[model samples]
Target: MATYNKRGYKPKTQKEKEEVVETDSATAEVFSSLDEGANKTEEWVSENQNIILIVVGVLVAIALGSWAYQVFRVEPRAEEALVESAQANEYYLQAVNATGEQQDSLYNMALEDSNGKYGLIKIAENYSGTPSGNIANYQAGMAYLNLGGANYQNAIDYLTAYDGDGSILEAYAAGGIGDALVQVDQKADAVSYYLKAADIQSNEFTTPKYLLKAAQAALDTGDNSTAVSSLERIEEEYPDAPEASTAKVLLAQAQIAD
Candidate 1:
């Protein structure tokens, strides 16, 4: 027998031949490992198939339950709350315009259920997560504040719970809380809330009004620095506001106190 090499071809070296064998073995081991891992994964999944199915079923049930709750319960309740609050809101607005005993009577009507209609208090309590319910809280707080006396505590409770959507209502709610605190002689707390109201959403109407209130509350609490700052802000930012004139007088007083 005889062997011949082709032109420009060389026979394999021992080291090269060994390296080729090692490379092929390494490739085969990788493929074998992958196959083994796949088989184990399949076995594990088969063993836990029932548990996996139950988990998926529970997830689907939760998603459907949330959807049904929003559609059937929350949406209808929100609409109902809005409708129920209409009469109470009207009474509240009328109370704002009325005076003396008439105003108190109207505010009482708005606060309590009457003629089978849900009042602001009931609306706020029942539909707590809804938008109309939230507005009911604000209205109820204002009504209690107007009613005065021991109702100041109720006003504080309701106004403190109100969460406004970055609107003017937020400033009004803070200012309302401040008013209730002042009535209760919590002057220091009242000053902070008044300042919060003035800062929540700055505008000519609410900003100057709350700033002036904050200054007075601060002065009452002997917080001369806060009083001075609030009054100065009003003088500089809201010179044309009705509160500005009062703010100037308070500013001089606060400076003297400081």
Candidate 2:
């Protein structure tokens, strides 16, 4: 038929009319598919309304419970732990920084504060799940270690209980346990712990230091194989570390002993 164009009135060609019809059909098909999809979605929703509602209710309950737990339990406990830890932390610092008998005295005070409300042992015992408590475990372990005598086992126990983020503190805890084990005559386990400390985060400083310790422990146990291995690891992985030179000398000695 005839069609009016922007330029002028003109008769529609058969091809042009066919093209227009095809375009309309394609548009209609797209709309039909969309409508079908919408209808199916509505049908599914209607069919599974109870299930969907139950799922949503469960999700909402979980969210609310999580929020309530954090607010009512976690936050308050953390705050109290932090407050107690502040005093404990001061004592711990004093213990670590002091000298001679004063250091040991401060360490004892930190382990068993006079007030009894803020001490590493108390915090670790009472608030074992708190962050401050976790730190308390490490502090207590180190305190026991510094006290030396019969506290080596205590150091091992408390340090073994510590769980820290993958930080230098974790390395220190592992290394502390290794030292304690060595003192307790657990040569083999001490070697294992020293290697663990060196590998935990694998930094140039802690790794090489612990590796050197591992080598020494191995040598002490007459395990020339492990001594060589640890020393070689230090030379290969931490060649520029301060322990590297020492590690090389140790490796030479261990080789001769082997």
How far does residue 52 in candidate 2 sit from its true spot (Å)? 1.6
Summing lDDT over every window of 10 consecutive residues in candidate 2, give the lowest-scoring window: 2-11
What does candidate 2 score on TM? 0.80
Residues forming the 10-long window of minimal summed lDDT in candidate 1: 1-10
Per-residue lDDT tens digits for candidate 2, residues 1-258, read 335333454437887667667766998999999999999999999999999999999999999999999999988998899998787789889888899999999899899866757688989998888898899999999999999999999999999999977878999999999999998899889999999998889888899999999999999999999999999998888899999999999999999999
lDDT (CA) for every model shown? 0.91, 0.91
The most accurate candidate by TM-score is 1
TM-score of each: 0.83, 0.80
Query: What local lDDT does model 1 show for residue 155?
Result: 91
- Give per-candidate clash totals: 0, 0
